[model samples]
Target: MTIKPLIILPDPVLRQASKPIERVDGELKRLADDMLETMYDAPGIGLAAIQIGVPRRMLVIDVAREGEDKQPQVFINPEILKSSEERSVYEEGCLSIPDYYAEVERPAVVTLRYLDRDGKEQIVDADGLLATCLQHEIDHLNGVLFIDHISRLKREMVIKKFTKAAKSKAI
Candidate 1:
């Protein structure tokens, strides 16, 4: 599988809501494979399709700890069905945002419905890292970033930083 180039921060496309996948086919499967490869190459636990310039409701994740077997999962057109009122915080990072990380609070448990690579529907009740990862990726599909969950001052600072970096690179 090819490792696709990640669309980094300050890209207007990241703010665009992703469209749902119409069907699962060999081409879609190949894209998922490429997404997994790109996520692994990023050394990140999760990645959204929008991160790679594909504004499609898809994400790949593997929350396996070090030394554990990789458990790659693909979610197509994922939607959160339910979420617990209880909150949990995790220091989250994004491949698109690169090195920046911050603790963000979200539901401690979540139930999600999505189509697998085979186009079959699957519903999963997730907690801990899985829940957080799913929520983060789902937010991407909605044109939301982890930074959006943070304080406004911080979020604006981050956007400014990335915006400046982008301008410098263009020079």
Candidate 2:
């Protein structure tokens, strides 16, 4: 698997909704492997296909702590089946957003269903960091960023900062 270049913020591609994976074929599986490689290299817990400019409803997550064996999870066309009324807050940073982070509140628990690596359907109940990560990545699939959950002022500030940084780098 190859490590793909992550698409940063202000890239119009990141705002486009991803298409669902029609089948988990060899190419899709390779993409998933590449995503896992990218996520680990980013030192992040989760990553969505859109972050790599794929624009497909796919994500890879590995919540394992340092020193532990990697437990990679692939979600193909995932959908949240249930979400808790109670909320939990987590400081979320996106691969697309780079260094910026914002505290976003979401359901404390969630149940999601999706196709696994083998193309078999599976459902998993998640909470804590996993729940937050799943929600955040899934949001990317829908063209939503974690900053959208924060105050408008903060969101604009982040966008402006990234936009400026990107411009400077382009010089």
Candidate 3:
């Protein structure tokens, strides 16, 4: 599978809410494969379809740490069905945002309903890093970012930096 170009921060496409896939077909499967390859190449634990300019409610995640067997998972039209009141914090980074990272708080546990790669429905009860990763990607499907969970000052600073960087690249 070929690795797709990641859409970086400050791109308006990254802020658009993704549309749900009408069906999971061969082309969709290929896109998912490409996404997994891109995520691995990015050396990131999670990636959203919007990050890859797909604008679909899809994501790929592999939270397995280095040296462990890669456990790539594809989530299509994912939704958080339930979440715990208890909070957890993780220093989260995004493929779209590149090198920047910051602590973000989310539910310690989440129950998600999503379509698997084959279009089969799957329910997952996730905790720890997996939980955080799932939440982050789902936010992308909804036109949100991990930085949005941070303080306004920090978020604005990040947006400004990326916007300037994007402008420089255009010059």
Instruction: Pick the TM-score winner.
Output: 1
1-171, model 2: which lDDT tens digit per residue?
898999999888988999988998999999999999999998799999999999999999998988999999999999999999999999899889988988899999999999999999999999999999999999999999999999999999999998999999999
TM-score of each: 0.99, 0.98, 0.98
Report the lDDT tens digits of candidate 1 across residue range 1-171.
Answer: 999999988999999999999999999999999999999998899999999999999999999999999999999999999999999999999999999999999999999999998999999999999999999999999999999999999999999999999999999
User: Which parts of model 3 have CA positions greater than 4 angstroms off?
Assistant: none
Candidate 3's displacement at residue 148, Å, is 0.4
Error of 3 at 121 (Å): 0.9
Q: What ranking emerges by TM-score with the best candidate at the front?
A: 1, 3, 2
lDDT of 3 by residue, 1-171 (tens): 999899999999988999989999999999999999999998888888899898999999998887999999999999999999999999999889989999999999999999999999999999999999999999999999999999999999999999999999999
Which of the predicted structures, 1 or 2, would earn the higher TM-score when compared with the native? Answer: 1
- Candidate that would win on lDDT: 1
Give the alpha-carbon lDDT of every model: 0.96, 0.94, 0.94
Clashes of each: 0, 0, 0
